[model samples]
Target: MQTFHLDAISQDRQTLAEPYHEFLRTRDMSAGVYHMEPGSHDPQGAHQEDVLFYVIRGAATLRVGDDELEVGAGSIVHVPARVAPRFVAVAEAIDVLVVFAPAESAPTIEVKYTA
Candidate 1:
C-alpha cells in the first residue's frame, strides 16, 4: 500500500512560473500537484499520453480541440491521447491534480490556444 500526502510536497521557489511539485511518476503514469496564482495561467501545450486534470481548488477553463469549457472544484476533465488540450487557471490560485498515463506512448500533436 503506497501512501502519500500533498503537504509532503513542498512549495517550489525556484521559478516565477506556477509551482509544480511532482509526487510520483512511474513507467505507466505520472502524478503531480500544480499551483497557479490568480490571473496566472499555464502554457497551452500538448502531450502524447492521455491526461486527467482534477481540480482540487478554485476554478479554471479547459480547451479541448475547438471547444472551451469551465471547470471548478471537484471537477475532472479527461483528455484523450493524441489530442492537444489546454487548461487555464481562472480563479485565485487554483490547484490541480494532473495525471498522465500510458507512459507517453502515443504520438504528439500540435495545440493552439486563443483568448
Candidate 2:
C-alpha cells in the first residue's frame, strides 16, 4: 500500500501551465492541491484527459466554456475531454484538488496559446 502525506510533499513552487505550487502526480492518476493567492490567475491549457477540480478551501471563479461559476469550499467542477476550460482564484486564498487520469492513457486535446 502506498500513501502520500500532504505535509511530506515539499512546497516547491512548480509551474504547471501557469499556476505554481506543490503538485503531486502518480503513474495512474494525477492529483494535486493548489494554493492560489489573491490577484493570481492560473493559465488554462487544454489537456487530453478528463479532469475534475474540487474546492477544499477559499473561493474561485471557474471558467468552463462560455459560462462562469463561483466555486468555493465543497464545490466541485468537472472538465470533459477536449473541452477548453480554465479557472482563477478569486478570493484571498483558494485551495483546490485536481484529479485526472494519466495523460498517456486518457484521450486529451492540447490547448496552445499563441500571441
Candidate 3:
C-alpha cells in the first residue's frame, strides 16, 4: 500500500555509482528510477535477485551475458539472478525504471553502475 510519482522523484538527481531515485523497498521487491547520460556505461556485474529494466526514455544497447540488443523507450529487459549484464553504447541519455524481486540487500560486486 504505497505510491510514488515519477515526475517528483526524477527532479532531483544524485551522484553515486549510478544516479537514481529509489522509491520502494520491501521484503519481496524493490524499485527505483535510474538516469544515465549519453556515453555513460554501467559497470559489468551480476545480482543475486532477478531484475527488470523498463526503459522510459532514450536508447541504448544492453548486453546480458552473451546476448545483446538495442533497447529504447517502451522496451522491457529482464536479467536473471547471478547473470551479469551491462549497458553500453548509449545513443541517447536514458531513463529506466528498475525493479528487483526478493529485494537485493546490496550489490554482489564492489561497484554497480545502475539502479
Candidate 4:
C-alpha cells in the first residue's frame, strides 16, 4: 500500500506537462494535480478514458460539451470519453485533482481540455 499527501505532492510534483502533475499511474487508473494561474489557459486535450475533476481550490467556469458550470472549491465534475472540457473566466488560481479510469490513451479525436 502507498500513501500520498496533497501539499507535499503539489510542491514537489514532477510535471509531465505544464500545470498537470501526474502523481500516480496504475493499470486501472491514473491521477494528477492540475494547477492554473489566474489567467492561464488549460492545454490538455480529450482523453480516451473517462475522467473526474475535483476542485481543490479557486474558481472558474467549466464547460463540457455545450454546457457551462461555475465551479469553486469542493466542486466535482465528470467528463466522458472523447469529450473536451475547458475552464474559462478563471477568477482565481485553481488547483484541481484529476483522475482517469483505465488510465489515459492517445486521443482519436481533436484536442482540448480543462483540468
Instruction: Assess each prediction's global lDDT (C-alpha) against the native.
Output: 0.72, 0.67, 0.81, 0.83
Off by over 4 Å in 4: 14-17, 106-108, 111-115
- Residue-wise C-alpha lDDT for candidate 3, range 27-74, written one tens digit per residue: 999988888888776865887889899999999999887779999999
Best by TM-score: 4
- C-alpha root-mean-square deviation, each candidate: 3.8, 4.9, 4.8, 3.9
Residue 109 miss distance in model 2 (angstroms):
5.1
List, residue by residue over 34-86, the lDDT tens digit for candidate 2: 67778876665666777788887887788776668999899988887666667
Model 4 superposed RMSD (Cα): 3.9
Which residue runs does candidate 2 get wrong by more than 4 Å? 10-27, 104-115
Q: What's the TM-score of each model vs. the native? A: 0.77, 0.71, 0.86, 0.87
Residue 61 lDDT (model 3): 90
lDDT of prediction 1: 0.72
Stretches of candidate 3 off by over 4 Å are 14-18, 110-115
Q: How many residue pairs collide in each prediction?
A: 0, 3, 0, 1
lDDT of 4 by residue, 1-115 (tens): 7799998778865434468777889999989898887888776566788999999999998887667899999999999987878887688988999999988664535655355
lDDT of 3 at 62: 90
